[model samples]
Target: MNMASDHAHDRPHEPPSSGRRRFCQACIGGAAAITVGTVVYPIVAFLKLPVRLGESKPVQIPLDRLIPGQAYYADFHGQQVVVVMSESGPRVFNASCTHLGCNVVWDTAHSNFHCPCHGAVFSGEGQVVSGPVSAPLLEIPFEVKEGNLIIS
Candidate 1:
C-alpha cells in the first residue's frame, strides 16, 4: 500500500459552480437597487415639500360686527375664504371646494354655499349637504374682538 493514499491531499478540489456565481450576482444587484431607491426617495420628498406646505398665515377677523345671515369674503394668508355664522358658532372655511379648487358661492335661497363647478354644497354648519364631495368644510381659527371677527 502506498503512503500517499492515506493523505487527505490526494482528493481534488473544485471551484464554485455557475449557479453559485449567479446567486451572488443577484444578491449584489438587489442590495444596490435598495441603496439607490433609499437615496432617491428623500430627494424627491424634499422637492415636493414646498407645494405641500401651503401659504399659512394667521389672520384676524371682526367676528362681532358680522351678522348671522351674512357671509363675508376676504383674503386670509393668501387663501380665499368665507366667514359665516352657524347655529353653533362663528365658522370660517376655505371657500375652495374639497373636490376641486373651484370657489364656492353663498346661495341665499338655500342658505348654503354651493360650488358652481361641481355642484358641491355645504350647509351653514360646514357640513356636506350633497354632491360628489365627501369631506366636511374646513373651519379656521377665529376670535371676537370689539365687535369684529378675527380669523387666524
Candidate 2:
C-alpha cells in the first residue's frame, strides 16, 4: 500500500549536524593542545637558563663586633661561611662538611665545628679533628680591610 514511503524511511540517516561536528573537533583540538603544552612547558623551562639578578658582593663584618671564642655565621655567594675568632687571629671557613655537604655547627662549649649528620668534628683552624671525614673544613680566604673582615 505504501512501498515508496517504506523505502524512504529505510534510507540511511543523515550525517550529524555541522555545529555538533565542529564542537567535537574543537574539543579534540583543545585536549591535544593541552597535552602538548603540558609536555613542552617543563622542557622549555628546564632548558632555559635562570637569570642571575644581582652580583655577588663581598661579605664584611666589623672586627670589633667579633668576640674571641664565639662564632660568626655569614652568607657568601649563597653559601654559608663561618668566622671564628681565636687568640691568634680571625679564621674563616666554609661551614659545609666535606663528607656529605652537611652544614657544620659551631660548638662554642667544645670550641670546634661539629657536623650533626655524620658526627664529624673540625678544629677552629679548619683542620679535621675526628669522625668519618678525611678532608678538613674548607678555609675561606679573607682580609682585614679598615678593621672590617672582608670575604670576597
Candidate 3:
C-alpha cells in the first residue's frame, strides 16, 4: 500500500464480465429509465391527459321535486341512477340490470324494477325478487344535503 495514494491492491480485481459490466449496464438502464420518464411525462401531460369536461365534485340532484310512489331518473357522472320515492322517503338504486347491462325501468303497476331485455325484476330497495338476476341492483353512495341529493 502506498502512503500518498488510496488503492485496493490487496483485494483481487472483479472480472469485467461479472462486476464492472453489470455495474455499467445497471447505470445505463437507470439513466435510460430516467430519461424516458422525463421525456414521456410532458407528452403525457400535454397529449395523453383527458380533457376537463366538468368538476370532480359530486352531482347534486333535487330530491324535493321527487313525487312519492314514483321513480325519478338522473344522470350521475355519466352513469344512470334512479331514485324511487317510496313511503319511507327516498330510495336510490342503480338503473342497470344485474343479469345484463340492460337499463331497468320502474314498474308502477307492479311496484318493482323491470328489465325488459331479460325480464328481470327487483324491488324498490334494489333487492332481486325474481330469477335470472341472482344479485340486487348496484347502489351508489349518496347523501341528502340541504334538501338536495348528492351522488358521488
| Highest TM-score against the true fold, candidate | 2
> What C-alpha RMSD separates each model from the true structure?
10.0, 7.3, 9.3
Query: Which regions in candidate 1 have their CA more than 4 angstroms from the true location?
Result: 1-58
Instruction: Compare the candidates by lDDT and give the number of the best one.
Output: 2
RMSD in Å for model 3: 9.3
Candidate 2 per-residue C-alpha lDDT over 17-115 given as tens digits, one digit per residue, 9 for 90 to 100: 768677998999999999999999999999998877664889999999999999999988989999999999999999999999989999999899999
Query: How far is 123's C-alpha from truth in model 1 (Å)?
Result: 0.7
Clashing pairs in 2: none
lDDT of 1 by residue, 1-152 (tens): 46766664675643557687679989999999999999999999988847636456556666556677778888877778898866667788888888887888987677898999989889877789999999977777777767767676
- Arrange candidates, best TM-score first: 2, 3, 1
Name the 10 consecutive residues with the lowest summed lDDT in model 2. Answer: 11-20
What is the model-wide C-alpha lDDT for candidate 2?
0.92
Write down the TM-score for model 3.
0.62
Q: Could you give me the TM-score of model 2 versus the true structure? A: 0.68
Decreasing lDDT order of the candidates: 2, 3, 1
